[model samples]
Target: MQDKLSKFEKAALLLLMLLAGIFGGLIRYFHLKYGFDALGLAVRGNRHAVILAALFALITLAFAVVIVLALTGRLFPKDAVAVGTIGAPTILLSALSALAAAVGTIVTLASAVKQLSVWGMLNGILFFAAAILTVPVVRKLSVRSDSASPIGTASLIIVFWSCFRLIEVYRTVSSTPSVSVYFYDLAALISLILMFFGCAGYLYGRSGAMRVYLTVAAYLFFGTVSLVGKGGLCLSALFSGAPVAMANVTDVCVYLYGFLFALAVIPTFFAPRRADPVAELIQAAAEPEESGKEEPPVL
Candidate 1:
């Protein structure tokens, strides 16, 4: 039985992602900038432990659902899984990330290096190099082959940045790091390692980095929501009179990648599955021979 998703089905899922990702992202950004939760939903009184556990459960369940849907051809035909197509959103995001990273880093480095001292200057340099590494996003507009290097490198930089970014929020529960904060850092580290191998392997002409790229994407998703509703701990403290770090200006690395990859996975992975030619040939040959045989009498 054919089990491919109709356009409407695909649209509905995109809408869900839009609500959960894009709209939810805006709320997080707003809270981070303002240092206050308008909705008053911040977890308090040592309950963050429970919230962290529930958060992982939700993310794990969401990932599993996406996997099952994609693999079973519910999201797209399994036949088309091999030959994926590019979408506009992917291109737009690629362009935006590249430009934002390049321009943001350059501008900030120029303006803030004098005031930033050595550590900030180093961060500015590192971030600038990382930004430059994202060239493939704009130049090639795809993550296949050695081209994955840029994104792989960028993912590593994001992991490095998150280390500094999440330090303030790493609350301790029973002398252990809070699950929400620590888990995200752990995911970023793992993705960084995977992306390194994926990119290195690709350099040797091996394209074993697709899954690694997805992992990075997943980590980015976590990063986008890491500070949501967590007042006073947001990396971006625009309205709270906090001094913004130079790196924060170029943080499009995490935000932009998260948005792009989450959506890009859809078009790059989905297609109308075409029937296997060899299988069709075999079936055709077998069918003719079976048809040549006499039919059994009906009972």
Candidate 2:
């Protein structure tokens, strides 16, 4: 109906959204590697690592609130509070859980190479698998004309966060000399690559006729980033004698950059497009004739 946003306004908003995603990803990445407490939290939890995790949890909650408010004022405004409240908590929890897993993996591995027993390693596998399973379900869900499904979008966010941590696990454990050890890390690394591509395809509007091609491309992009982040971490750790803190930070930098690049697609998906009111009017006029309606008297 009304064009509330000028081209400049639209461009600026798009840029802001992209920045938000990048910053958000960076925040999550840092929370994962260092433990929120280590990042400068005054009150620490035996249960929680840092005040930062709680703070990030709060930030994710805010995103949920804003998205809910927008949806409520627009399409689903009536149920906005309920949806936002219900879904926001999940987002917060998922982010926290992901961070915890990363911290756990790093601490466990760093303590000694032998600490990653069969069960510990298996737990990591399951975490990675849960994320991998989510990819297909997410891509299968129908995105609405105006917005991505809340559930689907949230799942993707979880996938990225978890998969990133899975990469962290690999970076930590691969330093050990055990051959059996490297296999799991290697597999997780490959899995991360696969998931990234799938994410890219779903973002690229590849759900249509060219779905197969798009899926492959999406997976490929994801794989490339996974490889780069992991490979870089490995090479750097080799030279620097990676303390756990620095290793975590290296992981954060790699993921931060990857997410930033991935975020560029967000603008194209949400960008403004041209419309034709005249054609719509002409079509409306012809509809009455086709329905056998007589023209009214001109008087």
Quick one: best lDDT, which candidate? 1
Please state the error at residue 24 of candidate 1 in Å. Answer: 7.2
**What is the alpha-carbon lDDT for the whole of candidate 2?**
0.40
Residue by residue across 83-177, what tens digits does model 1's lDDT show?
Answer: 24356655555555555556656655664575765554555565565555543432222334434454544545644643432332233222442
Model 2 TM-score (2 dp)? 0.34
Which ten contiguous residues of candidate 1 have the minimum total lDDT? Answer: 165-174
* Model 2 Cα shift for residue 280 (angstroms): 9.2
Q: Which stretches of candidate 2 lie over 4 Å from their true place?
A: 1-51, 74-261, 272-293
Q: What are the lDDT scores of the predictions, listed in order?
A: 0.46, 0.40
Specify the poorest-scoring 10-residue window by lDDT in model 2.
77-86
Per-model TM values vs. the true structure: 0.52, 0.34
Runs in model 1 deviating more than 4 A are 1-49, 61-79, 82-88, 103-122, 135-205, 208-213, 216-220, 227-236, 246-253, 261-267, 270-299
Q: For candidate 2, write residues 1-299 as lDDT tens digits.
A: 13333334333533444444334334333333343244333223422234324543554465456445443454222221110011333334334434443544454444334564654455445444443334333233223222464444554554555455566567666665533323323433444444444443444443321222222223223333333434455456757886654554434333333333233222222233324467689999999888997779999
